[model samples]
Target: MTNSISLLAEEQVPESYGWLAGGIGAVIVIALLVFWVASLISIIRSGYSVGVKILLAMAAFAYPFLGPLIWFLFARHKEHKTRMDR
Candidate 1:
């Protein structure tokens, strides 16, 4: 009986950790979604042409992590250039 109880207790340990991991994953996904929306808004306000804005927004929306990378690499540089010009 004691052996059976010990086995049951060991099984519960992993299950608790599984729940913790799942909760952390949920938080990460929500945070990424919020960041994506903010990036999209910044793209809109970057003063690019309508066509360029649409392209960057679509790219960022389609790929959450990669989208921001592309925006920072290309679109954001353009924004900085425009600011310097002014």
Candidate 2:
């Protein structure tokens, strides 16, 4: 009974889905790389001082996904507000 159940479980899972999962994962990684690169470029081009630029770049490099997300959600808006006041 145990052998038959194990065989049935293995048969039920399709092997073809491996490629689909790999493709999806590759797309996600590429998107993250693009986003990270864009964030780095934005930081470099902003009006921030040299020290601030270094710190922001470091944060982005260290945290990868979370760092850019924080910058976009919080720091970017703050920078925009400061610019508007100027």
Candidate 3:
């Protein structure tokens, strides 16, 4: 019984800590949303077709840095070279 009580106490977050945690969470969420919107805009402006733009935007929003890196390497950069070569 004492162990269970201690566990419950440990699980209960202090109010101050809770507010701090909530603020931090809000910041993280806002940052991610900003990043997603920026990435989506970049994808849209890159002259890709609708399907590719949607795919890259989704990837950039969902997977963070890796998604943009892959898109840059495989799609954006490839198109740049093709245009330059032309």
Candidate 4:
């Protein structure tokens, strides 16, 4: 009986920890995806290369906030100068 109780307790601890970790990881992945999509939309609105947009979107997955800033400063600025895209 004592062994069974201890085993149950041990199982519960790992399961709880697993749930917490999974929740946090899921949140991070979702945030990454949302930021990536937002970057894609911004690039699309400004009329950049489709391939370049895809690459820029992928970057948000790693550095969620930085991707758009870089795109705005570099890609969007150049797109304007080209003026053919917009």
* TM-score of each model, paired residue for residue: 0.69, 0.75, 0.57, 0.47
- Each model's C-alpha lDDT? 0.81, 0.83, 0.73, 0.72
Q: Could you give the candidate ranking by lDDT, starting with the highest?
A: 2, 1, 3, 4
Name the regions of candidate 3 deviating beyond 4 angstroms: 1-12, 61-69, 72-78, 84-86
Q: What is the lDDT of candidate 3?
A: 0.73
| Number of the candidate with higher TM-score, 1 or 4 | 1
Candidate 4 residue-wise lDDT at 71: 74
Error of 2 at 35 (Å): 0.9
| Cα lDDT tens digits for candidate 3, 1-86 | 99999677657977568777779989998986776666667788876567777888788877987787677567776656544322
lDDT of 1 by residue, 32-84 (tens): 88888888888988877788789888888789888987777766877765653
The sequence of per-residue lDDT tens digits that candidate 4 reaches over residues 1-86 is 99999798677769659778778989998986776677778876766567766676687556667876687567777776655632
Overall local distance difference test of candidate 4: 0.72
For all candidates, what are the clash counts?
0, 0, 0, 0
Model 1, residue pairs in steric clash: none
Estimate the Cα RMSD of every predicted model relative to the unseen true structure: 7.3, 6.1, 5.4, 7.3
Instruction: Flag the better candidate by lDDT, 1 or 4.
Output: 1
